[model samples]
Target: MQQSNAYIITFSIILTVILGLLLSGTSQVLGPLQRKAEELDTRKQILGAVVDGETLRKMKANEVLEYYQNRISSIVVDIEGNKIETAPDGSPMVAEKVNVGKNYKMPAEKRVFPVFIYHAEGNPDAVESYILPVYGAGLWDEIWGYVALKTDLNTIAGVTFAHKGETPGLGARITSSDVQARYQGKEIFDETGTLQAVAMQKGEGKDYDADKHKVDGMSGATITANGVNNMVKNYLQYYSAFLEKTKSAKSSDVVALN
Candidate 1:
């Protein structure tokens, strides 16, 4: 016997409801783990500044977390370089708790930036380098990555860039090792101490270190190249306040020792 239209309608409705409920339940069950995975991926990207990609990709999840928790030191600071230990509401402010994706939504002055200090291999207390999270507009969408600075804070050790939807083999080349390698040994400050963040002009890096502010730009991706230049310059200026303060303190200690 064929079912009536009424019966079919009722069955369809019930089936839809059951599937909806099941999907919702599954999402709820997997939500925490999904978020945890995403956070670890972000950590991996941040670690790209110091750790090579090949090693990062081969590491296990718990190993990555253990390495980050032990070898890395994180701190949150305002745009002015002041460390923030308490939120305005009196709650604890922790660097690991900062959501940089969300924090980017805030205004420039209100933004809370996170700095990751990667300690030396055998010295947990000595910072081998500093990593700063950087984000900005790209030719097609948002671009971001981590920039690592040497202990002097003037030399750029390395950079790792990623984009939302940049064209493959073109703008996406920003993530390529060949492109990122152009930043190595480049200084962000001039001899006179003025901030001169690296510039990406095609083929200009043959003269690398000549200007102290230039890097080899990606071929055939001028817009993305300009975006990178601005991203580095603006973010470097924002982080400079903090580096200057730290540099001054170190100078004072040396003076006392002398």
Candidate 2:
């Protein structure tokens, strides 16, 4: 078989084009499913902040999505605590579209905040909890989590932390039930009603004044603990407007009744 260099080059070019097209087609076909899975996983993580691990383990993807849709009501707000449906130019203010990682790099004044309110069954107005998203630097890379606050907005109801590359036996311990449980009943506000983001004190937490906003840090993860401390505080400040507004309304109601 005698083939000129030009002929060989043409054949190779055709084969390359065909392979590229096939890959593109495959990606087109699978893209939606992959995105669907990712969505379900995110919903699961958000649910993890509220539901128990065992209960979540028994649920399927559709169930997770349904749980999110039914139990969670959400809003998108800017740094100033004003509700935004779209940008100042009138686009849809999609809560799910904001990327915290990207927003983190932007100036604080330019960041958009998303708030998720979970309501108990059959209670439309009675908010079960307020779930806040938080992320920041860990010892190695980035770490993030969801923290659910009681209606009082000061007491922590539940917390779920995850990290990109924290130390397994130390920093990564934040994900442990025992570690997170320490946050339960901890207040994020001081006696004077000031927002005092919860701190992670070194030790067994027995030394920490939990009622006054302190949690025990991971055994040997001081830096990671500090990251969590800052993360929670940052989010607390971001959410202050909504929290304070609700707190004031409830307090006013009590005064009227008395």
Candidate 3:
């Protein structure tokens, strides 16, 4: 039996409409869950810079959120290192909400940097570390990370890196624990107080143990290594003013104690 052309067209249109409605309904139902998951992931990444990944992986999502809420406080600073309570457009500024990737597209002077402060477990007044977020271009795409500095504001406590796209087992190793561990305790400032930032040298299997500003390079991933080096150097430079201010305040405190 041959179907009439009008009947076939109407049937096709109804089917298309039904499928569209189903997709729309699914999106509406899952939207909040998806957003919640992304928020959790972001918090995890930020915490990963201060806490070890092994420990983070062992905890549940709610546990992670609770830990973050209890241990971390944050502030936003401009290019000049002034603490900003509001954004340029008069909106309240939240450190965790600042999009570093979006700020990367804006002019440097117009950008706001977010600083995450990790507090000692029992003492809120005692700051254990300051975690700064950095974003930059990788060999294949965008890369970013959180770098935690010790109380001295010079030594790296830990780092957590991520990327949009990169070759598997090559440049992608930037997220590996071994690679991140290499940055621990590395100094970003020289003896003269000049910000040197940490650098990942070419190749691997060399002893950078004695050097305060050098880390082991990724094997066969020179471009990615260079990207990491530049990202660290550039973001450190961007945060130099804030770092110096913090160092000065610490020195004053020491002097007062003496």
Highest lDDT: give the candidate number.
3
Error of 2 at 92 (Å): 2.3
Estimated TM-score for each candidate:
0.85, 0.81, 0.90
- Residue 2 miss distance in model 1 (angstroms): 17
lDDT of 2 by residue, 168-218 (tens): 999999877778877777888888988898888875546565256887777
The better-scoring model by lDDT among 2 and 3 is 3
Global local distance difference test of model 1: 0.86
Q: Per-residue CA lDDT of candidate 1, range 211-254, in tens? A: 66788777789899999888888889889888998789879988
Q: How far is candidate 3 from the true structure (C-alpha RMSD, Å)?
A: 2.6
Error of 2 at 38 (Å): 2.6
Residue 196 displacement in candidate 3 (angstroms): 1.5
